[model samples]
Target chain A: MKRSKTMELGVGLFMLAGILGLVFLGLRVSGLSLSVPADTFTLQANFANIGGLKPRARVTMAGVNVGRVSAIELDTDWYDARVTLELDGALEGQLSRDTTAAILTAGLLGEQYVGLSPGGDPETLGDGDTLTDTQSALVLEELIQQFVSNMVRD
Target chain B: MIPRVIALGRHGCDLLEALGRSGLFLAQSALGWPSREGLYLWLRQMHFVGVLSLAIVLVSGLFIGMVLALQGYTILIDFGAEQALGQMVALSLLRELAPVVAALLFAGRAGSALTAEIGLMKATEQLTSMEMIGVDPLRRVVAPRLWAGFVSLPLLTVGFSVVGIYGGFLVGVEWLGLFEGSYWSNMQASVDFIADVGNGMLKSLVFALVVTWIAVFQGYDLIPTSEGISRATTRTVVYSSLAVLGLDFVLTAVMFGGLS
Candidate 1:
């Protein structure tokens, strides 16, 4: 009986430790959250070409991360790449209607992200509002082609 | 030529017979519910399988992480992307190495022991005595160990990944002078919970089931002799290790081989 008691105690501690490790992996290592932030709103932008933009990529304002790219899909009506940005609720009413959204890379070769530059317009963009002014991701091949064509003309 | 053909056919039949028996063995040992005493037996087994293996898992995980960071730092520095070390280390450990390495170690540490213990019991006719006394040896002997392995391995894998990530942090940030904030932040940004960590846990779960099944089945099905016990113990380790590696490839292809 005494031996069984100690065995039970040891097993209980082992189980606890195992569970703690899993919880740590989910929360800390993977950065998963149990609850979504209550204050978040989505804004839409359309690009001629988004290049390699993926969902969950960062959305930055002046190089500071503000939110994430929640979704990217084709705008069937416009034949353009449509991106949905889930931004912090605090900045919901601060962005102007004419704000420019550009697809930018982090470094010489890095993952692509969406960068938002606020505009001079006083009209605030609200939930689900679409940004009209947008710049497509820069393609190196196209730039090279244009440079070669200009050189030939010269 | 005739003798060679006969030998080939005989080995084929033996392989089929063993495969069928193991299938039935898995079903019998895995499907039944445990009685009250059986619960204690399971707890005891968990203590043996999980607690006993923790030290090796942790120490090896730490060293593996440190080595990865050092090697990744050297390579990434050449590309001027040394800051991506955290993302590289976390992804590699969470997605691939931790679960695979932990399962390999579990096969060696606990799987072989389970086989030898059961094999020894059979050799001494203890299992036959249990049957003579009306206690089902399959329920009393095999089920608890199987359940213990199933519950223990994923936990160990998770523990391994957590320790390994910190080990990388120790080397990359503290020793190598990479900024601490970017190391963690970059990892957080790239490592998805469902895609990387969740798939890793699933892989360990499958490996746990396969490894324990092979261990117990090898022991129960072996000839009751000293030499037989030794052979079964060796087969448990080798078969489970091979199974873990092969299954990892299949699972990775299914989980991450996205067309898009």
Candidate 2:
């Protein structure tokens, strides 16, 4: 049986639209983004206990990401986690010398990243300045152990 | 006891024989896939199979999304993490529900229809008459449908997932009064395009092969009678559904388990 060519073409276009919609959704929803931030200045923070705070984790200020963790090492002298953060050049002077970098979990069970809560200070942080105040990840196991031990003592 | 043993041996042999024959038929249909007319016919069949099946898949996706959000919200509230509802719903759809549910529905709707249509054509002697008139039934009839099933299902699965995510958004944010930014941001943060979304598409593509093969083969081999057509149609659904679920488990185990 001969079918109308126009209707078939229309259906083909409809099919194209559906698949394109999926492609758009996949790009938008699935964060397989490849664009990397290159124009960044490096900063460092020292922590007593990093606790699963991985490299490439976002370094955020005021709940907005301003940098990413570039590297993590152990300081032989202080025996602490020495993390290097790649702060965006656009946010160069936004952070002050007293901007405290704390390792915080995204959600209760989610991954750990560096968060900044600015402090009262007239001094500003330069590209290579080390943040003096740093808080480590709150280990759930440690908290639970403390609670259990305190309860047992009571 | 001797007769029972003989019947069991015969049944196993019949199963193997059908499998071998289907493999040959599948290859032959694939060979006939390149003709221009075959391509046009395939698009038409896709219009029938995919476009026609859109409403049910989207509606089911919508409801499935709403239910996931509602349930996720109820549980997440206890932990004070109700904001991750979008991540939960998106993960559920992309990782599991979209491919598996869409394939099952495709089997139920398009697979059975293909089987029944071909079986009826055989019963009415249309396939036989077409072959007698110098038209290769494999090229003209079977190949187009097999191609359509291949082309239609993954696209349908994509559409289903899209609709389902919106459905989750509607229920999770609008009705439940959750913050909208968290819904999208949490999803963007949690769901990986490669592992979850990309693998979901792979699962659907594999299912399309399984389903269309079963549907077309059942219809082609059907006996030319009303009872035979009905039985073939029923088998198309049953067998395709079982194959999809079983494959989904194996695929999930391989894709996700090997990752971590």
lDDT of 2 by residue, A17-68 (tens): 6777577566668755557646788888999999889886888888897878
Per-candidate interface C-alpha RMSD? 1.7, 2.0
Q: Best lDDT goes to which candidate?
A: 1
Q: What is candidate 1's CA lDDT for residue B198?
A: 86
How much TM-score does chain B earn in each model?
0.97, 0.97
lDDT of each: 0.91, 0.88
Chain A TM-score relative to the true structure, per candidate: 0.86, 0.76
lDDT of 1 by residue, B138-173 (tens): 899999999999999998898889889999999999
Instruction: Return the TM-score for each candidate structure.
Output: 0.94, 0.84
Name the lDDT value of residue B249 in candidate 2.
94
* Top-DockQ structure, candidate number: 1
Model 1: what TM-score?
A: 0.94
Pairs that collide in candidate 1 are: none
Candidate 1 lDDT at B102 equals 98
